[model samples]
Target: MDDGCNQVNPSAALIDLRPVTVLDSITELQTADRHKVAVTGSHGGLASGRHALAHGVAAVIFNDAGVGLNGAGTRSLADLDRWGVPAAVVSHLSARIGDGRDTMRSGVVSACNGTAQALGVRPGHSCLAAVAALRTSAAHAQETDTAGFASASGQVGPHHVVILDSASLIGPDAAGSVAVTGSHGGLPGRRAARALKHPARFAAFNDAGVGKDQAGIARLEVLDSQGVPAVTVRHDSAEIGDGSSTLRSGVVSYANSLAIRSGARAGASLIEVIRRLPE
Candidate 1:
């Protein structure tokens, strides 16, 4: 037997794989992390699929939201397939939806696109195992001049609508604007009420699969306590990180007391309800 070249435990080779990026939200993707394998806390939707493509990541992972409407939550798989990008999502039940470390630490694969399946990724695989496959994958990153997504601002009736890619972008100056963010409607770490930097006239967030224990919509009640009208659009109904898309097409999935009182009912267009919210 030559020097320990033939290690029996093949897993050792995968233990120290470098160049992977873990993000609580895909919007946090930076230039440094591009072309690397990305594991994020964002949901796998059509818009999110585009965001990942725009960043030119080699591979990506996202969270699968609950009770998808017309397959909105896991629609990214098919979208990625068209671009020859490998993609997959962890089960919302196995990990908190908006926490990336938790997703990588505890998530189990829930779905995969054809490209991922070709690489041996499968349902029930742990997040690490999936990343390992992507690490050694023969897949190449596709580059395009596609402009990266950015926050968009517009108006709805008399409300100044601020559509943000992440709720974390909310700030003191945003106090009176109606905020439509792509951040999950869940509280950060399921405890920290951090989405709002300052009080807004109203806010909307993505209901991240309404995952286990309804962790997805956890922020609604908290916002209501502060007298802020808040609502969550279903993960399936809109992109998880495209604020413009969320505002343009999001349908309400959950609403807090104040929103409900304001006629923010589930299945109604978020823009429609916002028109009636007091300025």
Candidate 2:
């Protein structure tokens, strides 16, 4: 395997030859990084993979996200192989789920497509190792602002609805408001309180295909412990980076105890669920 497992020495030569881009989210993908290693903190789901492909990244590494719900997480590996893109995923347990730097710093490869394997990238190697091994692969790039979303706020009856492209957009002002975000409902680093820094009246996230151990919906239970109402939209029903799509097209896939008590239920439209929230 040309995985460069033998290259334990951090050579300034190798790093300068093929500088890879590390992104906290694939949403931060830039046009300059095309045809270079793109290591992202995003889930290894097909949606995320497709996003990278659209930008023409050389190779991508993502978190496996517990390989949830029929393997929707990391499903892109197989597809990337078909598309001839070298793709691999790190174990969910290796680092924080949505933080790209963490993924590269400590993430361990859990799987890689045949294309990556053919290039000597494989499971058990560190993400950085995988990055170095595949640096020579043809990379590609695209562009988006670092903020990642055009956030807005409005009212729904007595409740204020804050539509954000990413959960990271939730501000202190949303403490008593409602948040509809395009981010997935996973407990990054398993931090419960970090689910929503603000005590929003209610919140919603994408289900990321409800991957392993139901990790995609893990945020709901964790949010419950914070005494907050939360729900997740089904991944297929909405685009993951468009908060407007989350509201208009998302279907409630799961609800926390507080959400259920507040009239939220699975298999309901998010609009219907929001309408049912108590004043």
Candidate 3:
């Protein structure tokens, strides 16, 4: 279904309840004067949850996508808690709700973060119900400033490497550097392609199981088309769900190993691996 966006004013509430097909649509709320609660069709990945939280929403609802490896749902829930905003995830089945707009309006919540639990939102509750609870508990919402938490910086020996937990952290300056990221190798749209095109040295990503759809392979293809050197590491090898696992610690481990095996300099771009010769 085509992604859609809508805003509804719940009765007796001063803020609006927005339903969006993707987490990126949360930007639409930037111009809103009143507080908002977003219901998004996006997976409950660290990047998606962080995007919603950074936008200053009162709460957010996302699809669990089976919670994937490394407990993506659980990590998102923790992230929302740190941001002081209630967050919930509906079943992946709910992702098809009316052009994605209705997913948040009618889907049943499958999990909730700690902040949401404090607001009386529970698993098995309806998305609408969770939003209502958040509205009522808005007064208790903590004042959390996450602007500085979006992207973290680090050094890899002599080269400065940008460490991001998600693909959403990629920016204009990310074009020509060694980047270690926890984002899955799924190039979904033009934005993702553009972001992947910028890494000059090398980019590391999670394989996300390299499922039947072969999304992981597609990401590599797109990067190859753009002439970017990249590699996909097993998500479970490092930490999968939480931001801590997806950061420099995870990326560095894989990058270092790949560099050593490929005879690439420390912090240098990696050479694509060909088939190994039989011993």
On residues 174-227, what C-alpha lDDT tens digit does candidate 3 reach at each position? 765666665555554324444464554566666554432453334666665566
Instruction: Say which candidate scores most in TM-score.
Output: 1
Sorted by TM-score, highest first, which candidate order results? 1, 2, 3
**In order, what lDDT does every prediction score?**
0.79, 0.77, 0.53
User: How does candidate 3 score on lDDT?
Assistant: 0.53
Model 1 regions lying over 4 Å from their true place: 1-18, 140-142, 147-151, 164-173, 188-193, 225-227, 235-251, 260-269
Question: Quick one: ranking by lDDT, best first?
Answer: 1, 2, 3
| Per-prediction TM-score | 0.78, 0.64, 0.57
Model 2 weakest 10-residue run by lDDT: 139-148
User: Comparing 1 and 3 by TM-score, which wins?
Assistant: 1
Task: Look at candidate 1 and tell me the lDDT of residue 38.
Answer: 92
- The residue-by-residue lDDT of candidate 1 on 103-158, one tens digit each, is 88888889999888776688888888788776654456667654434576888999
Clashes of each: 2, 14, 1
On lDDT, the stronger of 1 and 2 is 1
* True-structure RMSD for candidate 3: 7.9
